[model samples]
Each structure stands twice: as structure tokens, then as C-alpha cells.
Target: MRNRLVAGALCGTLAVAGFTGCGIPERSEVRVDGRRQPATESGAVNAWRKEPPPRSMSGTDPEEFVRNFLSAAAGEPDRAYYRVKQFIAQEDDHRLQEKQGSEVELTVVRLVDKPVITPDIDSTRVTIAVQQVGVLRTDGKLAPPVSTDTRYEFGLRSASPAGSVDDGAGFYVIDPPNVLLLSDVALRDYYESQTIYFWNSERTRLVPDLRYLPLTVPNERRLNEVVKWLVGGPSDWLRPGVVGLPDRTELINNATGGNGRWEVNLDMSGDDRTRADQLLTQIAWSLPEFDGQLELKVRNNSVLTEDLGERRSARALYQGLDAPVRYCVYEGSIHPLGIAGESPGAVPLDPGANRNVVSAGFTRADKQVFAALVTASAGRQRLSVGTGPAPVTTFTKGPEHTAIGRPVWLRATDPHQPQGLVVADGRLYRFDQNARMSQIVLNLPPGSVTAVAASLDGRRIALIAGGALYVAALNLDGGTVAVGPPRRVATSLTSLSAVDWGDEERLIVAGAAGRPAIYEISVDGALQTPLKDDTGARVTHLTAFPTNPATKLPSGAFMYEANNVSYRSSPVERIQREQVLDVTPPPTGVRPGSPSAPFFLF
Candidate 1:
């Protein structure tokens, strides 16, 4: 029951059309009959377009036909993948019948080399070497490879006399692999990425789980497909920290609506009426494109919630931090970041005389307060918090010069009492508005936390431990900080240096697989999209403004620092190196001229 189009809405005709999932543009559409309709006709109902179904090439070499068959298998999901049978032996065609509903579950692999063909007297053997990429659990959710070793072999023979009677007969595959095989490209072209919403373990907030719905689904059935998947549950990787609808919850009928309005009716007979609000909130957040209402009914024709059966636009029901402003610490002072034009005035935190700042963060509650990690002695550092120009309140100190990570503010709804988190001596601690500090225990090896970033909503925390990425649910129940078991993600990145939330479902991370670069990874680890960063220097730090859902644009700039120089990037501006920031009052006496660690106040 959401009216506003947040993050991902329908493409082209945002208001009239249904959700298209991700921001990627729709592929060219072809009618279901595999032909284009004449543009000269006027009709009451608009014609539909989908990717043309794959067809086998005629009069082609057996090896060539094998290639075509492989390509055809990966195209639009035809009924039982019947389209691929055109190139299979009529006797072996029945093999695919068992593969129904498995088109989206097919294994995706990257071709390591060309297919090797071994010819025999009556048949040819095709051996393909491949590296497993992942598996398509749904249209949008690609589970990580189950094992490191994934290869396949196929057999083909000249068409039988009965098969040759057909038009331009080519060789038919003999015994093909029992499971379906698809290339990485086909996985991308056929599936549309959609995010499903789930509640945190505490049931206090909704977390996004990115899943895919195949583009092959007709517009009329897309809503039902999404709703069914939502009721089924969240992906396995995200299950550790999130909860889905009640067990056995079922859709009573197809989601019905039109003209930009829709309604979903769910059967929640076994569900507790007290939890109806939480269930409805999850549904509202998941279906941002359905700008109408939702109804939950029991089996006996009774409403699930006697007083709260109807739900209208829930856009504001679950919102995270909105548009952020970026700031930089220079020469013991904080200044608003400016790529061009005159820089804004510095925040008057008063870092105290002769104190060298290591890192810092700022937040606004009842009043503006700044936190910093500053050099306490020749080889030691201490964390502090204070208001403008007031005497700084020190929180924790590190022993033996152990480097302290930068301070990050958790979302504090109360204007008077803000909370921030920092890492020192390999232990995580939280600071409350009254400057009370408490350690947040994690189920990991001690001293493994290298860095941490709190999600804008303040319910989730992403951290790097032992050079690996992990995200955990943050439960602030009864004023005591408790962290749920941390779930490891982004395993593809062998080493991680920094991480930050790009949005609810995606994290902007700086890590290395083979080469060093920046990547946007879905929180579930199903998808990893690399951003353009050609800078040879390794990214040691990253600061991002969570994307604004209303405009589908970042509210502020995203800046990162590498090689001691800070660079700025945004939707309006491509990644570009910026000149060294000019310090306010220009530090004297051989100070480091390059600005480092610029961040946005969450």
C-alpha cells in the first residue's frame, strides 16, 4: 500500500506501467508468438513484447548446431524449455520434461575455453570446460557456486532418418547434461532484479532482500510472481538476520488492479492477529509500485485484523536516513566539502590545542556534536565526543598505539541523545548521548574487526573482520546493545579494506578479487556490480550517501580517499581526481597538504 515510487519503480511509463525491477532498461520486445506486431493498427489492448524465443539454426554443421543449441537453452524460459528440443534427438527430447520450473534454477558458468569435440563412428562428443559462476535460484537471486569444480560434457549424433524429414535437419544432441546450463550473459538478459522486503530479527524494522523475477513473466502475472516469492521467504544468505511472512501464508488469488493502483489479498489464517501490522508493513515496503491498498483475510471470511484490515500508502512507514551532507577534517577543524566554488565555513568543534586528529564523524541530534579519534601520545590514540568548541569528552583509549577506526554515528531518533560506534584495541563499543560507552559483543574471533559502518536506519551494521566482509543485525532492545550472529558476505572479495551502505540492499565496498577496485555488492551477495575506478591506488576508505528513494538519485556527493588524496564522485559527475583540498586558514609548517578521509554525516 505504497504510493511513492522508491528506489526501483517501473521503467519508461513509471505511473502507468508496472514495476520493471532494476534501473536497467528493458530489452526490445517481441510478441509471444515470436513476431512483431504491425505498428499501423489501433487496438483497445496494448500489444505485449518479450525477448524472442531462441530457435535452432538450420543446415548448420553439427559443431555449429551444438553451439546454437547451447545458446537456445539459455534464452527466454519457454514451457519446459521446449524451444531447445528442436536441436535435441526426438527420443532424448523428453529429458527436459523433468527440468520444468528449473529454467531459472539452471547453473550459470563462464566458458573457460572452446568446446572440444571428439568424433566417433556414429556420434560426436562435446566436452566444455567451464568455471561455475553461480545458480539462478529465482530470476533475480543468483546463489553463489556450490562448489569450485563445475564442468560438463554432452553427446551429439547426426539426426535420425525420422528427424531428417523435418526442414533443414541438423545434428541432434544425444544424451545432454541432466541439468540446464546457461551463460552469465543469458542470466543477465532474461532476469529482472527485484528487491523483497523482510523484517529484522527483532521485528522492529524491514530489511531489503534483493531477488530476481524473470522478464519472461507476462505483465499480468508479474505481480503474482513477486507476491508469491515474497510469501515463500527471503534468500538463504539473508535469512540469518531477517524474517519473512508467517509459515504457510498463501496468496488467495492473483493480485488485481490497474491504472497504477493494485490490491493484494493474502490468506493468513494461521498467523497471529497481533503480528498483522508487522506483516502488512513488510508487504507495503516490498511493493512500492503497487500504489493502492492491501487486505489480509482468514479462511472463514473474516479479516485478520479486526481494527487494522485496510492499509493505505505506507511510504513513510519504514524510512532510513535521507539525503546526507559531506564534511572533511582538515588541520584539526571540520569543513563542509566543496568540489568547486567557495567552501562552506568550518564546524567549530575546537579539537583542543596541540591535538592531532586521526579520523572523525559528525551528527545532528538536539545540537551538533562531533566525534574523533585523535593521537593521545607518540604511539597511542583516544576517542572523544563534544559539542561546538566545548571541552571534548574522551571515551576510550588504545594501548600500544593500536590504530583506532573512525567513529560512525548510529541513527538516533531522539534529538537530545545521539549514539556513535567506534573500534579500538580490536573491540567494538557504542557511545550514547550521555557519553556512556558499552561494548557490542560479536560472535567472531577477538580482535578481528578492522572497520565498521552502521546502516542509515541504524538496525544493521556492516563490518570487516579478518579481512572478510560480514553484516549483522543490530538490536537495541531495552537500551542494551545486542548484535545478532554476523553473516559473512561478498566472499568473492579476498580482501576488504572499507565498506559503506549504498542503499538498504546494496553496499559500496572497496576490496580486491584479482585487481583492486570498488564494487557495489548486494547485501545478500547474489550480485556484484563494479563501479568505474581506474585509479591504481588501493582504496583505503569510502564514504557514501545512501541513495534517495524519491528521485532514485543520491542526495549528496560520494567521496573516497586513496594514496592520501581525496576524490569526489556522484551521479552528476563521473569518478574524477580532485585537487588537494585547501585547508581553512591554511595549516603552517610543513603540514600534509592532501586532504584524507572525507565523509558524509549520516
Candidate 2:
């Protein structure tokens, strides 16, 4: 079906333009032609030349260059089609190309909606909607065009074509046998060649910026291979000031096999340089193998300058580490200084605390060092360590025991008594006082209570148990608890986890369900609109950043275990992906390699 459309379109162009067809040239013959062509005649040759070409021999302008190239390619109809397809494919501008085999057919469809272009003085951007219709023929005639609409923005570098050249300016069609055809190798080669042209062309004229093209060929296997190479290729190297807010970032340590661990560091710096500077120094490492066992560590310099500057400096210790640790130093010493640790558990920090916490994770005996440091820091009132169980003797105050069970979540309440909520044995327990037995406000059925969240005032709690939404209100003054009857939010939901207060009266909840949608629930139990309009893969987690009261845009949010994919909110504008830390370990059988390891160290 797609092939038929492409064939029809190509035949239509040939018939309408009265162009001749050319055969695919042999590789040897093509190479001969390429060699005979002076390097100076090549568009990209000038880009690498240190000296500019003689003004007299600058040759034709960009528009003329394009016309000439098209005309030359047209001499070989098959080659011309291949070149055109090659250029389109390289730019990933194809929305239609699907299957590839002999007699490749490509259907080019214009998008119903055009892109919105914001032009500058010398340059004007024109957005066109197009679909690449691709068809692979196994038998019979090509099928009808199967199109995928995509919008492409082309920047006219030298404004609209003017004077006698105006005919070739804007967009011009190279009469076929000169028009390029659609083919895998042809498109690839064409793009490779054209990229050179765009990069080096001496005359500034209408040329497609290959930089903005997407590699959209339909073959998943081929696409994956191409994408992998492109992402890591020289053409894709991270440029200064080009690192956008990553939707995700990942790091691997001991890639060779120290427990086969990796650390993903996120540049949450946003647009604020100062905030980014502070965030870069404080590294956060998550262990995917161990349920995202997050460890927060401070750079030695950041730590030393604030605490042990007189005895030792960070510059000294940092220089000793085999691998350089990434960090940014702030002007002032670390404020709210402290060292803290937790063993085999998630440590929830106060939202309002200063960003001066230093942490580390250790296996075996080193865990003791972390525990001792945390204990001493807590004793000195320098750090507040949130942990599950501290050995009674380790606590200088003989362990002011709070009967919170395993997987306990603590939130500071009034400083006098921190509130502890425990999910244990399929029941929810609230620990109020030091010696008092924990209160079982709600006894969840077996295999229920997947997640729990409290309102800002701690007066209400939301829980997901047995695939249902359960709300419980604590009557602090009345000394009573009212549990709302469980209500099914979505029957197909496999799991419900992330839940948070969206605002004073609304709760934002997300999870694995019919569709992973961020829902806004009012205090009165009205389900407002969802933040996401499309049904996506199950949402692993949802976190909201503090929103500026002035601007309603979300400041930050955490989306866990997200599938790395792209989506379009509209035809013209595509949301750019922000890089986040990639903490995930490599696949099995892939041996991890370390950045550095001394022969004797391992």
C-alpha cells in the first residue's frame, strides 16, 4: 500500500515534469565520477579548508549548487530518487517510509496542519508537515500509502531567493531524471554527502539544516543500531551549553564488576547556575539492583572547606581518587554542615533543610562507620539521621525507641513528636508517643496497601490498597479515626504507588493502570482532569517539584522507570527531551568496565 503511493508519486512527478529515468550506477562508476569531480567543486570541501576560496572562483551560490546537484543526480533517475530519499532519510524527515526491499516505494504526504514558524531578520523558518509513506513489497502490487505525518521546519538562511535566482529560491524541484529516489543506501549516502554540503557550502543559500533531521526509518532493528551509533557518534558529542535539562541521566561505576553497580547522576541544575553549582557537588547515586538504594555524597572539597579545612583539604583527597568526581564549589562554606548515613533503607530528608548533607553507603564493616558517624552527628545535634533501627548501645541516649516497623516513613510534626507511619503485615500503624504501642487505624486486607500519603496538615491520609483508593481522616482533637470506604479508581490498575499533595485541597496520584495518567483529586473526591492526555506505559513513580506561585509551571517532578520515547503534543512543536541520570545496570552477559582500576587494587 505504501509502496504504491510512492511509486505513484514518483511516476506522477515523472509524468508531470516529463523527466527521463536513469539507472542506478555501479559503485565503481560512481566512485570514478566522484574522484573526477574536483574537491573544490564539493560543497563540504570549503568547510575544512583553513583559507577561504578565491572570490573569483567561489563558483555558484547555494541555490545554484542545489540545482546543479539535483540536475546531475537526475541524469540517473534511479540514482536521483535514491539521493533524494537518502537526504530525507538521513534527516529522519520521513513520516511515510515503512518497508524497504528492491523497488523501494516512498509516499510523501503533506501534513494537514502546518508548523508555526518564528522567523528572524536574515533567516525565515518555514514549517511543512510531511508523511513518508514506505512500502515493502513481498508479493503483488505495492499497497496503498501508509503515512505518518510529521512536521519539518526548514530555515532559509539567505531569506527568500531574489532576482534571476528567485526561480530556484524558496523550494524548487529538480526535474527528474534528476529527482532523487527513495532507497535505504541511497538515502543514507545522500544524507552523508549533503551533510558535507551544508557544512561547507561557500554560498549561503536555501539549504536544509541536517542537524534538525530525525532518523525515522521504520525498521526497528536498523533504527536501533543507527540510533545507538548516532547518540554516541562524533556528530552527537555533547557540546558546551548544549546539554539540555535531561529528562533522565545515568552513570555507571565499577562497570567491570564491583557488585556490578552503577551510579546515575542527574543535572537538576535547571536554568539557575548557582543552584546547579550547588547540586553538581552533591552527587546522588541510586542502586537499581537494590531497589534504588539512593546514596547522597558530598565532594571532598565541598566537605573539607566547610569542616576540616585546617587539618585536610578536599583538593588533596580529590586528587587521590582514581576517577575524578564531578563537583561545583560555592562561594560560602557548606551551611548546615553534617555527615549522615543509613543502612539498607531509604532515608527521607526534611524538605526545608539546607543542602549541606554528606552521605555514603558501604557494604559490611563500612556500614558501621556510617552508622557511627550518623549516631555521633545526631548526638551532637549537627545532623538528624532517619533510620529504621539503631543498636540500642550505639545510641548515647540508650535509643529513644519509636515503635515504627520496617519500611517506616517519618515526617517531622511540630518538632515535639515526629509522626511515624508504618506499613507492616498488611496493616497501617501510626506511632504517636515514645512508649505507646502503635495504633492500627486501618487493617488492610492481605496484599493491599501498596502506598500511603498524608495531607500537608497531617489531618488526612490517602492509601492504595487492593487496587482501590482509601482515604482516612485523623480526628486529632476528637480522638477518633474515620476511614472512607474503598473506591476503585481504575479496575485494571496492577499497582498504585506515587501519591502526593498537589495543592492544599487536592492530591496528585499516579501508578500502573489502564493508562498512566496524573490525576487531580479534590478534597470532596471529585476527579478533575488529568495532566497527561495520552495513554502511556505504566508510570513507575510521580513526584512534583515546588511550583512558583507566580508562574504555575511545575518546578520539578520525578517520573520513575519511564520508557525512553518521544511524543508530540501538536504537529509543529516537539518537546525537547531533558537528560536524566541513567542508573540502570547494563544487560546480563555484558561485563561492566571501570573508568580506572589499578592492577593491584582489584
Candidate 3:
């Protein structure tokens, strides 16, 4: 459950780190006045409106000039510098203009305070506060409002026209502050976000490249902008794993959609002729958010594919980041659970088999099970990957830390033989049983890793280091996994002990729940809606049904010890007590009993 809508919930609508999975807005329809319009796209849900020209600052008050300047700053992305120049002194204009490339994008901002104007005989200094909403960076990323208290020093020249002794409307910029201040809010009434489609490296699936473009223009115009950005390619960060298959192909005109039909007019440039269906497929997939069919047109060209119906929707054609099963440690052994509620749901993994297995790892895609096994010969822990009663291949002979997080299986180029990732001694290891074992060095806080989880797409990985959550994009360098600078998942969370991907967008986390005693969190490190209040339960290990996304995670397998009994349940069903063995010993100050380590869907 997520927090309900409230004031100061400006960042609530901010897109989660990835638009490819759980954060993708479910299909929604829009109303154009009384009549219905196509399903509204993200960020573009604001009511359709003509982009009015920037207000004239020629004779306006200082506050009005400031207000108008904010519009100018964002109204044109390519001309942000000149627009800000309109509100700055001529002397300072050249500086802001030349440094435009370094400028950050800020569109929806609020005037935080009443302007404090101190008029002098020759000039005036007006100080004001501003907050911008949903900041759009020049690099094309969206973040919540920051630095709301930023003070912009604006130098005002009140040279009276005709020397009328009245400042009147003759006020212009004398000196202007260099930094822009802004805050973000839920402005579905004024803005919309859109998903630009791109092809995964395999060209088998289309991943989304999301952008928050201004809704100041008509929906079709905004769609044209989306198409252009799509053609340009994925963002700098997402480009490593995805390519724009339909990108580089020009749209002859703005795309138009209505009444379940969309028209995509193309220029047929740069291999467009050879890959027309690919372009149509990308368009079909991206546009179906409106529940519409696609009609592609190339000017003066004969009808190539007459029924350019939408070939796919990004959702259905795309099987998001998981296999369709879940595995749990029930009754001291690995067991399987149906993701879509399948048959033989809670069967013991290797019935009657004696093993030194502590925490087992099984991928949802297939039953290629791996576990942290105690090596009898060396008395050290190693990752073992196998199919049946006995281990076949060893992943690591660890000299690492004593505690290890559950390993995960990711789809490999071979599809049948997926690779694995695990954490030990605060270091990440990526290995294939038959191949190489390499350390995934990341620039993160130093400490033994308590938990690790990978996204279904194999593009990002999340880890808990020193009780804080960090996420990083994955890159393949030659033959090993490389992590980019990890992005801190900071929010209201404190003392995070365990984490798992609940869905594509959120993470199911446990710490010390809410203010009233509940513990749940999203991937962004914000509080999730509590499942149940005051169960007096402390979750030590958590796992989700991989097929049915754990977005709300109200139901899932978790082990919590209450009164010396380790009980594992779906958090909503009858509890089944398991023998207490070795719990990961909840990070120093906390106490609970359960051998329940991180479990997964096999």
C-alpha cells in the first residue's frame, strides 16, 4: 500500500527510476471537456490547451516579470538561455546565454513568497521565493523540487518613460540571479509524461525511454515531440542495453490518435523503407496506451502495409522481469509456489534429501537451483548450482564474509543457461558455473551486504549496504558486469534491514514499519502503505510471487518469530511453524529467530 494523497505530496507523481516495469502507468482514458478523448498518456494528462505566447514584460510589475521569466525559462527547451535573458540585465544576458547548455530545465514552478520590493531613486531590488515542480533536466531526466529556498537576486531598472516620476511599466532587468529556483507538484492538470519506445539489444523486445515533456502544446504536438525523441534514441544511461529500432526514422508530420486509430506519418529516411514494419511495431507498441490501432503513412509512397494495425502493446508483448514461479523455505526445505496460483503449489524441492543448504536460490524462469552450501571439506561457504539432489557446479569458494544474501539467476544470451549474481563480504559477484567468476566492483558505501536483488530486465541491481539501499545500472565491460555510480535510494526510510523487488516499480522492504509499528517501503525508499497495523510481527526474511507483481505485497511468504516460534505464512493465511535454525541475526540491535533467509521464485 502506498501513502494516500496529501499536501506536500509534490514528488508523489515523480516517475520511479525505471519506466519499463511497475511504474508504467496503467492505461487510462481522458475526457476532452464533455466528450471522451484517447487514453491520456503520462505527464500529458493536463487538459489540452494551446501554448500561449510568453507574457510581455514591457510594462509589468516586478512579480509579473518574475512570473513570466519562469515560463520563458521552460517554454522553449532549445532557447532556454534567450528566454531567461528577457528577465535579466543586458550585462548579465551574455553570461547566462553562453552557459545555456549547462542550464537545468525547470517548467512548473510556484511563487513561494510575496515579492519584497525595495525601490531606490534610480533602481529597485525585489527578492522573491520560487519552487519548481517536476524538474526537467537538459540531459532529459525528471526529479522532484529541490532548493526551494533559492534566492534569485534580480536587479530592476525603473527608468520612467517620459520621466513621468512613476516607475509605471518601464521596469526592466538591471541584475539577475544566475541560479533558477523551482518546486514540483502533482500537476496532472497541466503536464503529462510519455514513454518513448526503443528496442532491446536482442531486438526481440521494446523497452521504454520515458520523458516528461510539457503539455503546453496540443496532444498531437506533444506526440510529435515524443516521436522525435524516440528517433534520437534512448537516454544516455539506458542506451547500453537498448537501441531505438524505429529511431533515426523521421516522422513526416505530428502523430494523431483518436477513436481507436492513430496516424503515424513518416519521412521514410535512413533505412525506413527496409524496416517499415519495425517502425510500425514500435509505433503500435508505444501508442496502444490509448487502446488504439496504428496507421503509418509515408508521403506520396504507395501503401506499403495497408493495415498498419498496432502489432503490439508494450505491456502484452513484453514479459516483465521475472519467471512465473516463487520458491520459499518451508518446513526446513526449498519448496515451490505457483506464480499464477498453479498446481502442486507447495511441494518440497528435493524431498528427503539431506544437505548443508542454508539459503536456497531458484529462478522463476526455470528450476536451475543454487544455494549457499557449507563445504564439508574446507568448512567454507560456496554457491552451488544444480538441477537435482546433488550439486553439479560450484560458483565460488568464498573467503568472503560469513553472511551471504541469496543469489539470483538472470537470463543469459543462451536463454537456457542463465547467469547468477550474489553478494558476500559487501562485494558483488557475477558468475556462470561453466564460465568466469568476477567481482562486480561498485562505488558504494563500505560494509558487508545484507541483501541483494536484481531487476527482471537484467539492466539494474539493488543492494543494501550498511543498512542503506542503493541501485545501479548494469554494464557489460568486455566479459564481466560493471556497475555505474550507484544512485542512493533515499527517502523517509531508516534502518532498512531487508529488501526485494515487490514489482517493477516498488520494493517490498521491512525494517521497523510505520509510526504505529509496521514496516514496508518502495524502491525509492519511501513508506509503502502498511499491510496490517500492529500484528506485533517483525519480518526477518521476505519473498514475493514473481509472476503476480508484489506492488501492494499485501500477501506473500514471510517468516517472523513471535514468542520463540518461527512462523512462515503469506502474511494473510494460516501460519506454518518451521523449526528455528540460524536466522541472519537481524542487524545487531534487533532480535528474531528464523533460518528464513532471502527466498525466491524458482
Q: Would you list the C-alpha lDDT of every candidate in the order shown?
A: 0.57, 0.27, 0.48
Q: Please give the clash total of every predicted structure, in order.
A: 4, 40, 25
The lDDT of model 1 is 0.57
lDDT tens readout by residue for model 1, 1-602: 11111221001111111111243322231111222121111122224433424334545466566556655555344443565666678788777654545344566665556778899877888888776666666444667666465567778776546435545555778787765676544444455456667776667556666665554555556556667777788766556556777778887877654444445577764545645667656655555544433454545353543111134233443344423445665555455555443234344444343247667776654445445454545777666565432334433443333667777887633435566787767677887644455777788865467788877667678888888778777666555556777766633555688888766666777776467766666565544555523435677777776653543322323567777767665321322223333344445774455566777654
By lDDT rank, best first, the candidates go: 1, 3, 2
RMSD of each: 7.7, 26.1, 9.0
**CA lDDT of 333 in candidate 3?**
49
lDDT of 3 at 148: 49
- If both were scored by TM-score, which would come out higher, candidate 1 or candidate 3? 1
Least lDDT summed over 10 consecutive residues: which range in candidate 1?
A: 9-18
Judge candidate 2 at residue 103 and give its lDDT. Answer: 50
Give candidate 1's error at residue 196 in angstroms: 2.1
Using TM-score, give the best candidate's number.
Answer: 1
